[model samples]
Target: MPMRPPFFALSATLVLLLSIPAQACTLWAAAGPDAGGGTLLSKNRDWAPDHVQILKYERPFGGHVFFGLYAEGNNDPGIKNGINEKGLSIVSASASSIPKKMRAHQPGKRGVIRTILSRYASVDELAADADRVFSGARANFYLVSDRSKVLLAEVGLDGKFSYRVVDKGVQTHTNHYLDPKLAEFNVSIGQSSSTRQARINELLTQSPRPFTTEKFAAISRDRNDGPDNSLWRNGKQHTVASWIVHSPASGPQKLRVVLANPDQPEALHEYTLDEAFWKKN
Candidate 1:
């Protein structure tokens, strides 16, 4: 059942992070025996609709192609969640509160994904030089996936980033730091969810036989399933966008993507990896 660990890793991570107001974006990734043995990633972006758009670009060096969910007219590491031609998908969730220490005395305060995408091609490449790459960087959170593996990269304000392979079964994270050491600086109210993460965890652990995109959608679209929380919240904390990306077993260009905006049916905007890369500007 382990198909889309990294994809759904974005799913779980995003779901748990996008908690309240414009202060959150949830992400999740699931693989191993529970993900239908395929890599699936999903995200729920909660923000002002006017600021979000799906963007595409040609790699500077390789000139292959890549795409990401980003703010309009933004390319300076503008991707909130996106995938590259190598089937590398990256999604990031902002912290409601970053410890003051994580900030570096560098130029760009936060642009980690774009920096990696601009230089290397895969999560392995980024991981190899994580220390050197993230030097003079601020705190950042992301779920990035390559062809064969998924990773949860947490860069704390202390100027250190940790990457963990979520290819095991399933993994989820929110804006709040889960590391006991990092939690010391976490002043978030409830970004760390017990009910929401638990529901996703249970579904990933004990769902029926084969896991399908529909099943994942159902869980994501579930409004009342959370005993202590809800995925599709209302008021200033409602969903701004929801999307799913699945990498094929053969190649990375033909990534399958389905996206919905404001939690409603999709309006047919460009999202598929191949189509996005082909997009003009």
Candidate 2:
């Protein structure tokens, strides 16, 4: 009979496997000339196969109107990401590097995404008040963008946050911490996060300058590393949806969405940023 593994080895393996976060997402944004004139924000939302995702149009009282993506059955404060009528867009990925103890003091965990979308009109405005706006929010890395700029904010649960704003080039984030202040807390559980991060960087570097909406969509659908660690995941927990927002310099913005639920056929939806589009959505 084949020899069995030692109990200690098995235990260690189990612990390591358990530490890997189930919610994995890949996020990135491009702005300025490289983006072909405006900004491009993309995300591949991955989660358990059982959770169905949906799109929602919400207009808050005395706030901007927007459309967000959410998991089915969880409405309020459940916005995974969205774009506002003002042309500002935001997307996020889990920052699992921050320990649970650090995330215990979340004060505005609920509806924070919705609140930001409703209130902030541009990358500059959001960056200017990011500290107050994200106070006590749960740990997560958010990529916020508009026609002229892109901002990446790393919000901690203890009311501390850091952000980087860029008018040109690309900014990317995975589940790990990228900010220097938060780097010390980097406890990236599995190779999946790092692998996906590197894959994105590689693809973006090799891609030609002046990226288009089609290029962004192709990147979101990449499966180079395989089912478990590719940009487009297809393992136990897979990419349920992909989002790409293009905010042009002199025209209406466009949103391209692809839903890939395991139980249903993949669907593609597009939207234009305009009064009529907002009203119908």
lDDT of 1 by residue, 1-281 (tens): 55423322344444544343434556776664455565667666655434445545645665446666665642222566666666677777765454222232435555766666656677677678777765545675677766556777766654656667756455666565666656643544353343455555666666674555556666666566432256644445555566666654444333334444443565435344555455556
RMSDs, each prediction?
Answer: 9.2, 7.1
TM-score of each: 0.73, 0.89
- Could you give me the TM-score of model 2 versus the true structure? 0.89
lDDT of 2 at 201: 95
Task: Assess candidate 1 and give its lDDT.
Answer: 0.57
Best by TM-score: 2
| Tens-digit per-residue lDDT, 85-156, candidate 2 | 899899988776644443444655633678789999988888888777776467788899999999988875
TM-score of 1: 0.73
Ten residues in sequence with the least summed lDDT for candidate 1: 97-106
User: For each candidate, what is the lDDT?
Assistant: 0.57, 0.82
